[model samples]
Target chain A: MNSTDSLIDQLAQDGAAPRPASLPRFVAPLALAMAICAIGIALVLEAPFIGMAINGPGPMLVKWGFSIALLLLSGFALWFIGRPGKATGATMATLAVPFILLAALLGADLAIGQRAFPGETWQRCLAAMAVMSPIAFGGAILAARWLAPTNLHRAGLVAGMFGGAAAMTAYSPHCPEHGMAYVAVFYCLPILTMAALGWLLGPRLLRW
Target chain B: MGKQTDFSGDTLDQLMASARAGDSAAYRRFLSEAAQRIRAMLARKIGADSELEDVVQECLIAIHAKRHTLDPGRPVAPWMYAIANYKLIDHWRRRGRSPIEFDDAADMAVAADTLASTDIETLLEKLPRAQADAIRMTHIEGLSNREAGERIGVGVSAMKLRVHRGMAQLKKIAEKDRI
Candidate 1:
């Protein structure tokens, strides 16, 4: 056997650690982040969960639908880019869907002559999201780091998006606003901010 | 894929599946094949096999460390190639910013391995005056921190800190220049 053969033999003795696809791994961390955000909303922000039920869950469900969809899609993209060769154009395109749909809805709202107003509590929404982002970001970064992501920047961006989406989902009940414009500005801004932060920090933090 | 192993019967996917299940023989075969393929791939990109072994070793180690990240449902080749490609980039980045060159001439390798003074001089020139003097005395001149500190009229720990910071700054400069 050559030196390479001997090296292989030695490495083989260590055995391969086979795992299920990474998609399922994202669920636990995301769930924990959402739980933390929910608790924070209840205790710190003092937003009443019962109040949402009183308001009829329609608006809350719509927000959940938007945030959760982005969460899953970005999570999917994260899984793809977390691995070395798995990043493809398709994974990126998939991530854009939620944003595209949200934009379309926002456009339709505007086209129908609905007045767009930055809700009075919009800044509060942003502040709450900002606080929750690090929690979700920490969880996603841990997973991404453990998975040994190659494209550190993209992985970080997706992780940030994932965090933002998780924050939005958990904060939905606290937010009583139904305007698509609010969702567009309040929701997309945090996700993008988190993504930009992730991009900036990826090179430094994600370097294995 | 070359003459490393006869993978005619079982494909890489099957081999990887078996490897993930702790089949030692299959794992060995897979790595052997992987090494050959990675070598060929690197050779194509780098146009030389001078540093091939180091890079291949890094790839294999990475693959082993990150084995759990791979999905058994996916084709193993893509995952393996992705890892190999990443290692390749790492190889390039490292080669670009290699800190010190060691010429292996039997006479020269031993004489001044640490005290490569001219190189240290040029490298230290980039640092601040205090840091550069601290590093020059302690490293190039082979003085202890205490001795160097006294000569430079600083405390021992302060001297050590300067040397440490100077070396770090030098590394940053080297990396920046390489890029």
Candidate 2:
């Protein structure tokens, strides 16, 4: 049989066998990596008020909420797109709404207050992107073994974007800054940076 | 994917939706119809070139690989038109009007316009090492998926998956080069 027939037969027999890649087969490993990364961040950073921020209705809640949404959507994009889907642009567009809102919030925050250009915030966020991308990309590359993506680099880019967002989700709890702009600048840039990194590394890491 | 009006998009879209849900019969039916539709579309786009059939097969394989991406809510023609467009551009480029060349590993699927070994090597360079190795052993050297998996220290299905994805990537690379 040609590949499509083989693939369809694969779906039927998949219940009884390990089979090739499927949604959960791919998701389990990436989730495990994110969990591990979350634990590592909590232990290593030892942020003072993580528990309060997580529990309290502060900006941390918003940051975490937005980051979690990004994580889920990016995760879905990564897994759903694994087999046959061209909805990445739409999905990525949905993914961008929060960032846009945050950008607007950042602009409004600057307009309302004489905020000094958060000098170290830029560096911190850039560093976060640099650090988190490889972790997420590494996680993604590991999962890439089973998840077959047709648009390889785009898969890698989304995977990296997922990674960056996961890192942000984990990192958001630690920071004292609460503005959406702060979250967007410090957090989102890293996600995109890693996504860009994924774009470049996609041609290499996600080749097959 | 551009526009093609030869077939009813709704019928093909439903067939694809059923196929994605694991209906083999639906998928087979879809392919039969899609093949005729794609062949006609390519003939119109690229003219009566000798590589028409080869490009047709390539487009079919691409459609199968990307079948999951087809939105049942949308028209299949545009989805199909996109795949055909990429495959045709790669085909014409492989017909040697472009400077860059890909390995043409899908050649075994079609006997038209067979490529040389050196072309494959240069082409494989663009891929990651493991994927390059997997495609080389399986497609170029004709190793069975299971045998290639054993050689590469991966499972047979993964070997199949890699080779499948590798060729798709090669097509993407070739398309990008045309721009």
lDDT values, one for every candidate? 0.74, 0.65
| Model 1 C-alpha lDDT per residue in residues B1-179, reported as the tens digit of each score | 33433233447777886776678888888888888888888755543333567888889888887887776556677788889888888776765576543222432232254334435567777777877787667666878878987764555645555665666677666666656
* Candidate 1: docking tier: acceptable
Best by DockQ: 1
Please write out the lDDT profile of model 1 over residues A21-68, one tens digit for every residue.
Answer: 555565667677778877887777665554366558765776888889
Worst 10 residues of 1 chain B by lDDT: B102-111
Name the regions of candidate 1 deviating beyond 4 angstroms: A1-6, A17-26, A49-56, A114-116, B1-11, B100-179
Q: In candidate 2, which residue ranges exceed 4 Å CA deviation?
A: A1-21, A47-57, A76-90, A111-128, A138-157, A177-184, A200-208, B1-29, B65-78, B89-179
Q: Model 2: clashing residue pairs?
A: A84-B68, A84-B69, A85-B69, B1-B81, B1-B82
What are the clashing pairs of model 1? none
Per-candidate TM-score against the hidden true structure: 0.71, 0.56
Local error of candidate 2 at residue A5 (angstroms): 13
